[model samples]
Target: MPKMNIKKYTKNYFMPPKIDMSWAFKEYPDKAPVWCSVDLRDGNQALVIPMSLDEKIEFYKMLLKIGFKEIEVGFPAASETEYEFLRTLVERDLIPDDVTVQVLTQAREHIIKRTFEALDGVKNAIVHVYNSTSVAQREQVFKKSKDDIKKIAVNGAIMLKELTEKAGQKYRFEYSPESFTGTEIDYACEVCNDVLDIWQPTAERKAIINLPSTVQMSMAHVYATQIAYVSQHLKYRDNVVLSLHPHNDRGTGVADSEMGILAGADRIEGTLFGNGERTGNADIVTIAMNMAALGIDPQLDFSNMPEIINLYESVTRMHVYDRQPYSGSLVFAAFSGSHQDAIAKGMKWRAEKKPAHWTVPYLLIDPKDIGREYDGDVIRINSQSGKGGVGYIMEQKYGLDMPKKMREDFSYRIKDVSDHKHKELLPDEIYKIFHDVYVNVEKPLALIDFKLDKTADGMRNGTVHLYSGGKEKVLPAHGNGRLDAVSNALQKELGINYSNLIYSEHAMEIGSTSRAMAYIGITGKDGKTAWGAGMDTDIITASVKALISAVNRLQQ
Candidate 1:
């Protein structure tokens, strides 16, 4: 070979174009889907900070208010707390007339007996029993053969049939072949058939064969195929309410559940925000909301979804990820300039027409349906962001239009800051930075004097004076933060005491000069909690505005 210096040309990397989502316009039937919230059992068990009995009761009340017919309260056989919670519901007659409380148990005599003990006086209940039947689970976990597992499942079903009959209880029987997703189709069918034979479900009484994707280890389409196959081959197909429970190990729980529904599953088993063991179960909120958007009645009153999300987060101590499907903070939020423009236009379109049909350009579902206010400032400009986002924020915040030149200048500045700080710019914080860079405001509430001192005896003295409305108010008080000092000073000047006040702050931007937004929760003498919010370049000013807003709310 000749010694020739040859250079190879490199191919340029090109990003694929985005696909249009107009296919969602196809009409689908409006059948109401059944929803089962495993929050008490699955969600609480998965939480690092589990809900107390009182919190569980509060959540149960909320679920009832939301019109849930069936709620899996808890595994009563698991612990004394769970047992007592179930007992309290029964003793107090808290279970509503229409609603049914569901309890889970393994296919064991003692466990089922304990579950029955917990449900002694319940008006309506369902006992969900399950056992490992798959080859992997049977051979590995149970160390049992296929015939052995089937015999156990049949015996368990017969026992439940007799138990419910003897007690004269209005109970429904449900069985799950644990790890059915990986089980041999024929074996699973045989096990389920044997159980159905023992139970002998009538036309009115259908047994729910809950097939759970206990671990999401495969693609969504594969799970759907498995569900379709099982649904087609189940022995008593018409007498069975096919159910699905998918976990989110591979982050496709929602997709798996939805496809499973399409593949013939009638009931869903999941937790709010996908809380469960391992990577958590599928999120019922997301699945229900998605179905609602698809023109199917998901049978959930998510009108106060924000409150529900907040309560779940508070009680469970599990935050919903920003990118999580419908319930996420950023699901309806947009950051691209084009996306913001489209969403803004979509809101305007929705103002003129009913949103029954999915005709909005950018929004997949109406934000109003889920208690989210229309966001005009969905886009912003930064190093990685575009002019759409920045322009939206500018126009929405100050009613200022960004001229072509100003847009470019502000875009470059945002990009520079973003690159330097390595974080996205918040709309409010970006507004403040823009105000400092381009607009100037005279100090409205300038601090004149402030002092905090402690005596040798450990008594603390705090005083603050501020210039406001052309008057100087010097008031002495005692409290925590400088913002609290200022609030107390104002309270003293106004002759008001805001004793039940809680304040929280969030940095709106990154780095040293970032602005902060404050949220204040105030409890009135009338026993009402009012929320107020404020944003400012100075954290102290933000807190002051929030406090003032809280006071204003009290007046209202």
Candidate 2:
């Protein structure tokens, strides 16, 4: 083994917040923050294959359908295709009156003018301008001081204001201290206040002062503290919408956005599934769903989540991980034996008790609320399964009612094959296994013929014929019940002995014309148990066939 030096990296905390941030702990967002999706802009730019103009239009329609009143479309001046896309929206009058389109640009002169040109006839628009003010950018990238960076932001805000006045339009403005998390707190506040002075925001024309964790350099709590300091010190607090745009460098974009919201930030800007540059932006789906779970209306409609995921993946040329929160294929799936058992019991309890709230043990929210079913999605059967989950699936899928002990016995058979194959068994495969192994089977001891006659004491006398050793034999017997009477005839005729019969039955279909299924378990003289199932149009026949199947299994 070779030893290598590991002290090549160290912590660098460039920004220090001025406030103590005790108020962040005392308040949590009771309502959903104002949401702005930057999917078509920030998210699309990061894709290896960016969306075409037509695809961007399709995605924009989807966002509108999902109840987004404010959608940041794209940067018009960045590319000719982007410029055409915005022109198409305006020229064709595709934007709705309720929705406002926003476009992003830097603090440069020509870029800011061309960005407004794309929103020529828009009903409502936001001209979003940003500048890099972090210590690293000032030192290395731009080689400028704090005063020069402040000039960029102030001049951009003035240009936005002048353009709106010259065009005789009422377009809102947004300013971002691009790397807000890395910029010194007092300097960042001073620049934002200067922009606020230039824009002169009011209750009717609110300016968005977006604070972005562009490179997420610290913990979520630290970001929240920084947001709290800015929230307290910013000028014209009532007229400014403090927005948070968090990237996932530390894998805590969601945490930073949530904590920022708790610290008095009023808006959230991100992509649908956190699709953006580097580690990507905060996932708006997760943040919104979190709000919904907390009894707050997320304002956005995610009811048909599968449709949203399909469209997002199709347009973005990206694949959503199977384990992604709330929208993944396996988000609601429970694979562990203990988790499945608890969920099964909880479902039964909710059905019978009819509780007011969703209280499934392993589930945080009712999956059906998002269009997922419990049968296939919940209670997955594999090597790590138990009787409760198997029994639940059997009952839900095929309407089979197995006794508790028999269910336990059948679970082992299912797990045996699944473990041998090293895979999870689907519902149809499990059903076929049950049918082939236990259903009314006739083998070495096939039923030949039987005759029954009623007696005076409610007992039935029976005569049964069977071929045991390639020869036919006749025997007569009597017992208290029909099954018992048949059992007596089989024992007497075939010299087979068994006792302690347990039986259950249920209607496989709904009406009187429906077929019935019966399950039976019996113990033989060797102290071993056998199980069976049978289906017939008549209940009595089903029971008789079930007993015959159990006897054959015992013999084998």
Candidate 3:
């Protein structure tokens, strides 16, 4: 064999610029988006730490509070736990009158019977039936012919229609061609038409043919084309509600759902925060917020999103990633210098105008809409960050007039640390790091000694001494708990009378022995608020330091 020399070659890659969504906004300008939560079904099934019945109930209530008119509670026939949850919902009359709960089941006799048993005595329900219709699904999963799947779907639809008619229940029927996105268009239409023929939904009671991208296999445009094709071809299309349920395997779930709507889908099935199997389903929060950005009200009441997020985090035990779209902690956070500068300017622009126009320099949607406070801390610096972030923090927190040189120096320091840490700095932590690096000073309040004692009668007492402002103050107090006693003693020494000051402490570093950070929110006598923080190896000391910081702020 002759020896051949191979030369290395590199090719330049160029991608198209992202399209302006103004056209979409203009085309679908007026119609209010329909939202359906698949939390109890899709979200529950996806969670590694599944919700208990009580947790499910709590989550269901939170969904209602968030103003979802339609919710898929669960596949009642799938498990006794699910059936019991549905039964509990019915028994307690927990579902809101206007809201409709949906139950999913295969097109089978026994499952449908169990589904009905679960829906017994429930008010306002939708019986969602589905069967695998794609060639791949039928051949791979069921090992059946297309005709067999069609018969099964038609039989299921007829059974549901008969059951609803005989029982005189106010229920709607919905059918999904499972894996419809991958199915042959003709076969999908055939199966959907067969089910529609059996149910024979009238114009007044239109059946919903929910086309789901069970596994997101292509781009959003492809899904839109599929949806449009189905909408155009389905028999008795006028008497049907075209619905879309898309998953997030490709990370295009939101775009796919929206494009499906544009392609004529009348309903959307998604989970809050896009919780589902694999990469999760479309996030209803992001979708609704997107609608709001288009000047269309999604008609959802997300006024208490923080509390809702807290509840969701607690029940699902799923941490909302800081970068997750709208609801994430860092969604509104700006770390880049240019971004922070633009946002700061935009905020000021909106503030100066009466009846401010929401369209501003950098904000896509107003933070206040989702009950988020506009704080500088959301913008921070790191290696990939810039000067705008540092300047914004300085002006907002310390009211410092940072010169350009100071900003450049700060930016360099931030970059140095960020490069070393290999991550962006949080706003609070950035300030702390900056203080430690540059503005090194003696401790403002030094904790000299503290002692906690509990009597045999279970009474708790503590004493705390601290040196601050050139004076050593000692105070003693009793409380129901050691931490409470310490807090009371500190309060007395500082003459700080705050109402309902709550202290939450959490470990910031890794491992059980790592130091912890304490966050303290104090409601002042004037009913306004301020937050203080401390860090220490001991949790109690950290909390005490945080409380002292709060008191010091009050004194200032």
Candidate 4:
């Protein structure tokens, strides 16, 4: 490996010197800002192969369904496909009355004219124009002076105003000082104010002054401070909609967006799942869902998260990572013993208390709110699982509330199986293990029949028939209850010595015809415990069978 020099790099971003830091005093946004999805343009262009026309339309329709009022359809002048997609939306009347479409263009005459030509019959549209304003772009890329770059932006804004007036259209205008993060904060604000002065926007017909962190180079707080400087110093401050378009070079796009909103930005332009240049754009799904988790209505519908993920992956050919926040497959899954235990207890508390708000531990919000189930999405079982998680599965799915000791014993057995198999145990597989190992063992001694009779003293007496080694024997005994009488008979006749028999029973379902299940645990002479279970329609018979099953387990 070659040694690297640390002296070669320098920070290119500049911070505002005289701005108030009041935006930092606020915690978070209490309401959602205006959301603008650039999925069709920004996200598509970065794909290995950009989306087909049909796929683009499908994606556009899904964006509308997700409650986005503003969608940047495409950069129509960039390609024939882009031009056709915009024309198709306008010609087929696919654009909704309440929605406004946005198109991107460079700060030049020919491209701007072609962009307007693509929006011939659109009722509501935003003509987005941009020019690079960062110091590196001026010195290295464009080789133009600061005044020259400012002239490009002012000319673009003048043409957007004149074109709207010439066509008798009430179209909106948006100006972006692209690469604003690497530019001087004061210079960026100056260019945006110049554009605003040309348009002379009113509150009813506002103009958007977008400051894009086109190549995020600093911490999130620096971006917020820059936004505050522009927001406080822009012309027509009340009428200008200050927008942010943050990319994720520093992996702080979402943080920049949230803090920027607190810094007085009014709108956000990004793509679904943050698909764009370099690392990606700001993930609108994450930003909106974060607001939802904070108990604020993001005004976006992401309830069916699975459906949204499916459509996004299908059209964009991008895989949503397994650990993606709130949208990934494993986001709600709990595999560790402690996490599963806490989640199981939290769910039980919710069922018992029915709280007005969601406060489950290890879970920020209910998975059901986003079309995921508790059983399928949460409380996953494996070798690392504990008693609470296994017990929760049994009680929630099978209605068998075993005692604490029995549950601990069962969990060990389950973990042993899972550890040896080196795999996760599904719910049905766990139930099968319980049924095969403990339920209804009719081995060396089998219970063929039993007859119960009440004595004059109110004591219960029973004759339990037992079969072993190809022989059958009927024994009579008396005790305070049927199960006790059966246990006494078995000990006396079969010489199966055990004591401290623990027993419990319940109906599997809530119906008169429901079958009953019973469990029994016995301590052998070696002081170890064995557990068993049985089921029948009659409660007393179920108890006798349970006793027999326990004795059989002890003999084994």
Candidate 1: clashing pairs of residues? 337-388, 379-389, 380-389, 380-390, 381-390, 383-415
Per-candidate Cα lDDT values, in order, are 0.73, 0.87, 0.77, 0.90
Name model 2 segments beyond 4 Å from true. Answer: 1-6, 14-22, 448-450, 465-475, 509-513
In candidate 1, stretches whose alpha carbon ends up further than 4 angstroms from where it belongs are: 1-30, 345-361, 380-387, 397-556
Which ranges in model 4 have alpha carbons more than 4 Å from their true place? 1-4, 466-473, 510-513
Ranking by TM-score: 2, 4, 3, 1
Report the lDDT tens digits of candidate 2 across residue range 1-556.
9777679755544545567667666645779998999999999999999999899999999999989988998999998999999999998888999999999988777887888788888989988999999988999999999999899889888988987799888999999999887888888989999999999999999999999989998999888888888899999999999999999999999999999998889999999989999999999999999888878898998988889989999999998889888888888887777788798889989999999887789788888887788898888899988888898888877778789999999999999999999999998899999999998777766656666788998988977665555677666868897778878887876788998999998888433438999998899999989998778887878888888889889999
| Candidate scoring better on TM-score of 2 and 3 | 2
Query: Which lDDT tens digits does candidate 1 get at residues 308-417?
Result: 88887877778888767777777766766667667656655666785667776667777777787654323444466655557656655544444444455666678788
Worst lDDT run of 10 residues, candidate 1, spans 11-20
Q: Is candidate 1 or candidate 2 better by lDDT?
A: 2
Evaluate model 2: give its lDDT.
Answer: 0.87
Flag the better candidate by TM-score, 1 or 3.
Answer: 3
Largest lDDT belongs to which candidate? 4
| Candidate 4 residue lDDT tens string, 153-226 | 99988987887788788889999999999999999989888888899999889999999999999999989999
lDDT of 4 at 400: 78
Write down the TM-score for model 2: 0.96
Q: Write the per-residue lDDT of candidate 3 for residues 344-396, one digit (tens) a residue.
A: 77665667774545775656777777888666335656776777767666556
Local distance difference test, candidate 3? 0.77
